[model samples]
Target chain A: MLTTIVILLYICVVLFDFLPSKETRSTKERVIYCILLTVSFCVLILYSLDIKVPGPTEPIRNVIETLFKPSK
Target chain B: MQKEMISARQMFCIIIMFIFGSSVIMGVSSGAAQDSWMSLLLAAVFTVPMLLIYARIIKLFPEKNLFEIIEMLFGKIAGNIIIILMVWYSLHLCALVLRNFSEYIQIVSMPETPQLPIMIAMILVVVYMAKSGIETMGKWSIAMLSAVFLVVIITILFSLNKMDFTNILPFMENDFKSIAAGAFRLYAFPFAETVLFLCLADAMKKKDSPRKLYLYALLFSTVVLLLVILRNLFMMGPGMVGASYFASYVAVKLIDVADFFARIEGFISMNFILAGIIKITVCLMAAAKGTARLFGINNYRKLLLPVSLLAVALSAIVYKNVMEMIDFLRFYTYYAVPFQVIIPLTVWIAAEIRMHKRKLA
Candidate 1:
């Protein structure tokens, strides 16, 4: 139910907030906007479904741990 | 809209508030524990040179932002790649700040409230402020900074009775290596994060010196951070501070001056809200502008809504829980070094070489 509401809200945002300015935007801007919106929509859906989305900071954390091991 | 310009004072206030953003609530340089105040001082000193490089880059380029300057120095293809990286950095940083605020709110107040709605509401405010443009942001910063200062001073005064100055004994217990690392972490997280302001360098009024602006802001934030660290140390002591996720909030909780004036930790939340909004708005504006630049779009406002939504989504998924958030913060200094230090230093060098070539020609 939560996922459905979120999806509907996203569609409304894409149709209203994002689509109205499409005529004024260049092809590049429109493509970038669509890509970003799609990615965000997917992430939100995954979030609402209780799926674990991998954080971007994991790689950095691994590298830091390797370089600077905590002293006991 | 004509190019919006902010006065030097407004820029100063924005920089101070940005540095204070989440750091004030979470505590700074915690690796040194009792010595974190010293770590903050060293971090502030280290940041001066980085600020100088940033100022020099802006002064040399006159009115170009970091993205424009990157393109001018690295050529179109390489510059666009770097620009994308910078935009990603800004967006990711915005998400991290958003996550910090959401987690903080979840922990302190509204334990039962879902994180998603809180994050969405915060991002909406940030989007609205970003769409209003830099001029309004500068004005808001001035007002917010003053209010934050007053609250901080009052909180400190009230908490003085509970503080124990002797709690900071055995100052250098953490070896020199750890202390130095702590200083570096402090420098990168809050100090070097000022690199984002490079994107807004062109927004300053023509008469203002970017050098003075950077120096003044650094000094102001440094002093504010130093006082905050000292206050936390005096109140919570080293062991309590190092153990807690939000040391400053914990310290603020100790401020029970009298029966009539208790539960003043709400003021800390207010401070966080004011500073957090400014920080997120600035990052959102930078990300949107960088995206617009990437796509050759004339107006950045067109990209704000989508970029902000992406930021909110990223914030929701940034960490599994508050524990992961704390763990990531331990390594944030290392993660941010390349974007915060390496790129700006390289740009400064490139700008110097280019200026020399033009002078010769």
Candidate 2:
């Protein structure tokens, strides 16, 4: 049910927000927009399904830890 | 594209609100315990030179934002690499703050609801604000900052009865290392976060002094944050404050005026929302601007929705839970050093060199 809602919301966003302004955007703008939208859409759907999409926090934490180990 | 301009006063208000963003509710530098007040002061003092550098950068490049300045300074390949780092930083910061907002609401008020809905609602509002551009954001900050100040004053006044003066006794018990660590955390998270304002510096009128605007805002925010830290420390004491996740909210919850006025912790929530919106909007605008500059787009507004969507998704998965979020704060100071200090220092040096060369010519 949550997954369905997520899909519907993105659809509404694309239809209402993107489609209306499609004509004004340059080709590069459209391509970048679609790329961002698609990536976020996939991540949101995966999240809703409890699929555990990888986030940047873990790698960032690891890198910080490696560089600056906590003093016990 | 037409340039957006905000008065110096509006920029000051925006900076204050942005500094108060998540730090006020999260209770900055709690690692220093009762000496957090000292840590806060130390953080403000340490931030002064960095703030001056940021102001100088803005003065050097009056009409260009950070993205344009980077591209101009570094050229295509190197500048784009730096721009990508900055865009990631801005986007990640936006997501982190958004996650902080949702987590606070979920744990404090609405435990049953999932975080995605809260994040979505916030991103929508933030996107609208970003789409409106800096002028609207500046005006909004001016109006909302007054309400934020009123709430802070009211909460402080109401909670005065419960505040025990001795709670901060035996001050400076912690060693310099501990206090310095806490100060670094406070400086990285909130004080230096003002670096984001440089991304929007193009909006400030040429007549307004960036140095004056930044210093005034930093002074005002530091004082306000100090008062808030004192209030929390006096009410909750050092141990409880360190143990609690949301110290300000917990501190405000203890407010009782003859049993008639109580449970006004909602005021902290109000403060967070007002300030957090401006903070998120600023970050989103910066990220959108960076993305547009990367793709050679004229208007950043066209990318707001997509960037906002990505932010929402990222915020949803930023951490597994609030504990991880809080734990991340420890490492955040180090992670932020590159973007907050190193990059700006390099930019300032390069800019100085370029200016000197031009003068010689």
Candidate 3:
């Protein structure tokens, strides 16, 4: 859902926004970090989209659902 | 120089409104129905004496916290036990509140994101707010108080067309027990929970706070709460109101302007942003303060993250879904009474008795 994607992206923005200044990191290191962050964000997005998240997603969902469900 | 950084009036207003703000807006109507507002009025009458008692205790201690007062009265070991129990209650309180807010979001958005992350995110925010100290929190509450009132007015005015007095009819049809049960929860929430505000009273700008200010805040916040419940009842009716979880959201959804732009429930979401944050922050601050006192730590804020992470973890484990949480609330009302009312009253009485003996000597 678009709502889920927006929220995830917002979290990414908030998290990355906390990163120290670009001048502190080497260009190659920053690029590597960016790639990793982007991959993780995409993976979370795909999972939130319910598109069959690839990497051990079921366990995480179950753990999460168990904790926060309103239907308790 | 400001002896206390805020006034008791501001503190009282903030406490009264934010103590149970999210609960009233989101949950109270679901269980109490048409009489929900009446229950709150009953709560006010029941709680003022309790508040007065707490005020007296604060008067005696000057700047000491509840934990310190316990230690002073009971000695270190016995005092530590009381403080530990208080800490346990505080941690549980935080988890329960976090669950409530996460439930709110899950009902509205983020259906698949899981409750843990949402809850943890909120805990993080509250921790940051707590680190900022009471003044920042007080200022935020002032802003949110305005937002709560403004949204309240909007809901009442916008829903005027759908108002029905019949929804509130047949008041107190049940026997004394049911009414008392409802009234007790009414007091337990938003009212009795004002005990948490004492943590910030020493930070109040004025040392001497008049009872009138307390009355004003109580009346103002109560009116808003009442109006919100009344609106929910009128819009959703009693059965539906009591049956559903987010009655106010449903009430707002009933509003439609000019055939287009239906479902005004977004207002409830906006309301949550303010009310939800305040709820978590207040609980976190109380818990952190309690922990700091128990451990003899000079700074309570330092413990915020540990307490917050623990709360998030507890919230994650506390319930399987929403129903269990509601069930907890159902029976938890009885359990909450002692903590919310009895303990504080006992302290107040004990302090008074000690004072009386000292005077005689």
Which candidate has the top score in lDDT?
2
Please give the C-alpha DockQ score of model 3.
0.04
In model 1, the clashing pairs are none
Worst 10 residues of 3 chain B by lDDT: B1-10
Interface RMSD of 1: 2.1
Q: Tens digits of per-residue lDDT for model 2 on B144-217?
A: 99999898899999989999999998988999999988888899999998888878888989999999999999
State model 3's lDDT: 0.67
Candidate 2 regions exceeding 4 Å error are: none
lDDT of 1 by residue, A1-72 (tens): 658856876887888877787788878888888898888889998998999888787776778789976442
> Which wins on DockQ, candidate 1 or candidate 2?
2
lDDT of 2: 0.91
Tens digit of per-residue lDDT, candidate 3, span A1-72: 543643664465436442544565456544544553455455445544645533322343355456544222
Q: Write the per-residue lDDT of candidate 3 for residues B1-361, one digit (tens) a residue.
A: 2333765545765675565456655646425556666677777787777767777777787766687777778788977887777777777777777888888889778887776578757866887787777777777787777777687788788888877879988887655556656777777766666676655555644355534556666677677777777888888788888777777888888887667747777877787767777777777777777776776665565456556665665665566677766656544555566677777777777788888999999
Q: Arrange candidates by lDDT, highest first: which order?
A: 2, 1, 3
DockQ, 0 to 1 scale, candidate 2 = 0.71
Query: For every model shown, what is its TM-score relative to the native structure?
Result: 0.96, 0.99, 0.80
Model 1 C-alpha lDDT per residue in residues B87-154, reported as the tens digit of each score: 99999999999999999999998999888888888988888898888889989999999999898798
TM-score of chain B of each: 0.98, 0.99, 0.93
